[model samples]
Target chain A: MAEGSFQYITLAASLPHLGALFSNADLPMSRYRLEERLSMLEDEDRRRLDRIAHVTSWPGVDGCDTDAEVVARFEAASRSVQAHPDLAAVVRERLETRMLVAALRLRRDGAADPAPVAAWGRTAIARAIRTNWSEPTFGLGRARPWLRAARALCAAGDHIGLERAVLTEVYRQIDRAADDHQFDFEAVAFFVMRFQLIERWQRYDATRARGRLEALLQSTLAGAWTAGNATPTGAGMAGSLSQ
Target chain B: MTDLVLVLGWFGLFAPVALGAIGSSIGCARAGSAAIGAMLDTETGYGRFIGASLMPSSQVIYGIVIMFSLQRDPMTAEAAAGVFGVGVLAGVALLYVGIRQGEVLASAIVAAKAKPEIFGISLAPAAVLEGFAVFALVFALVLSGSIPG
Candidate 1:
């Protein structure tokens, strides 16, 4: 291990529980079960989760009937998580993505306030996103493509489709970096982001997810064929036909 | 003069084991930490994780082989210098590559835990580093033969 490198420890302490901490449970008593699991995490992680729980309580997501209140709680939780440097980067990116999606949906419906989406303007996330454009490990490359997709989706009034597109891209990023198995901060960060996306998709709209996933798969295969990289074979043809 | 020859020969005999062991120790420690973390996330793959953790230990084996090859009767100053040079340099190479391979394996283990499909592909980088260690081992063996016994 490199001197002064406690990166693996940080990752080990944090990554496994991200899905449980942020996921919206569908099962009966799952929230209580998740809370029990959260309690068992090491102190550093437990503190971060406690902060998020407090924010969630302020305008309890289920208690909030309006979309505006839900967005507010998201912002508040995102804001509070920043005090813990270890959790800040991933939390910020997650919140910004949700905010951007909410903003696009609201704007499409001619809502008066786009303020929630613009919340990132004053945050450190904006600076990080600006600085690290090509870095998939740091969650930098996601912002630009997400914004572009958000614009196109909002124009089409496909509000629910935002998550599927974002998640598809997240999965693709994970695939691209799957071979980057170095035990550094970057590798762990990528894992955390990938885990978060997997959990996010678990509760997303299934019909939209299937449609977007199929489209993504087609485009990817089409790209392979167009680039003359796809092996011309019976199996390839059959695979394409099955899809 | 005779003392100098014996001294250098002693250094040559132990250099590979010392350096190679250091490298392997660091590598195993790094990769082992990752294996423990991966185990925490998922169960029933302990065997593969343990196998991956042993990748760095190969460098030390190479070091031991080179040490045996460098052993010569009636050690002379000229032969000892050749042995010392080949042994120390090759040991250093093995050491460096082992540590690097460990880091790569650690990453591979964590990445594989998240996406098991990439497990085979993730091992490529570590295997490439191991190739470097093999190159060092082969060169040391070949150079040992050239030294006049």
Candidate 2:
């Protein structure tokens, strides 16, 4: 078989696996059609798309491909979804899960430099969270289960996992605040700063992460002026400190 | 007559500031409520609250400028009087703007309190309202300064 043809076949085969990874109670197979019309492209284009599948599925499987090459393929896939808005959500969800799983595996393998892949995972998770949260039709009340799974997945990793855990806790706090009808400007500010910190850490910008952490702490102090029912816990305090 | 006009102008200019200050106080209080909501429930976005808090000061600054302009040209009683009238009108308009802005800020606070995650996208419109008020104040200041004898 020709290299190009082989790549197409591999991508075809991997689609099912990708689809399976994203499958669960929340996202049923009906919601995500893995067998939909695959993009017909030139052999070179097919090869490029295949690289994304390869990187996300098995980054260690050597193809002498650079990170830029992988990122390009992923970006292209991202763009493709944009062009076909109907397919955007499912494709993004599948791709994010694949990247997250790959990053987890890399961390498990004790890769000397897993930062980049882990960062990608963190970004993908953040996007997923935002997307899920923004769906007005879905309603915020129904977000807890999916959020829990995503949070757990994030918590299972290393340093990145810890950051994700803190973020998840913050989101939980926000949820609790809403339920109790005690939403205050100061607490909201703290969460926004927390989100910024995680975002900085995801980009491997330690300086920004540290700065955001300090800002979050300062905001917490300033938040004392509001004085609501929710007690700032030691865990919450520690999480900000670690950031 | 010039002193009266000058006084009127100062009053007009400061009126907006007073209204803006009240608006800001309300906005800040609304934000506080949202923050409390966030603390009690899930996390709410505070950026909107902070933005609302910052918005009212623009009117206050406009009032200060108008007062200064009137004081600077007190000798030109006719010009000062004319400027003062315009300033008063602007201040009244600004007062209305401030009150409306405060209400919008309050609504945003409610939304933020309900869903903190949406904060990244929700603050855009409220900011736009605040921007309009700022523009009005700026225009008033410019107009106040350009009044001729």
lDDT of 2 by residue, A98-185 (tens): 4444444554455454445533434545344334433321132254344344434544645555444434544444334333221222
The residue-level lDDT of candidate 1 at B125 comes to 96
Give all candidate RMSDs, comma-separated: 14.4, 23.7
- Kindly list the per-residue Cα lDDT of model 2 for residues B1-149, writing each as its tens digit: 65787666556545655655665555454444333433333334345455654554555666566556545434465565665566667666556655555445545554554455665566667677667766766776677667764
DockQ computed for model 2 against the true two-chain complex using alpha carbons: 0.01
Please give each candidate's TM-score: 0.56, 0.34
List the global CA lDDT of all models: 0.64, 0.46
lDDT of 1 by residue, B96-135 (tens): 9888887888878877776778988999999999988888
lDDT of candidate 1 at residue A106, scale 0 to 100? 59
Give me the candidate number with maximum lDDT.
1
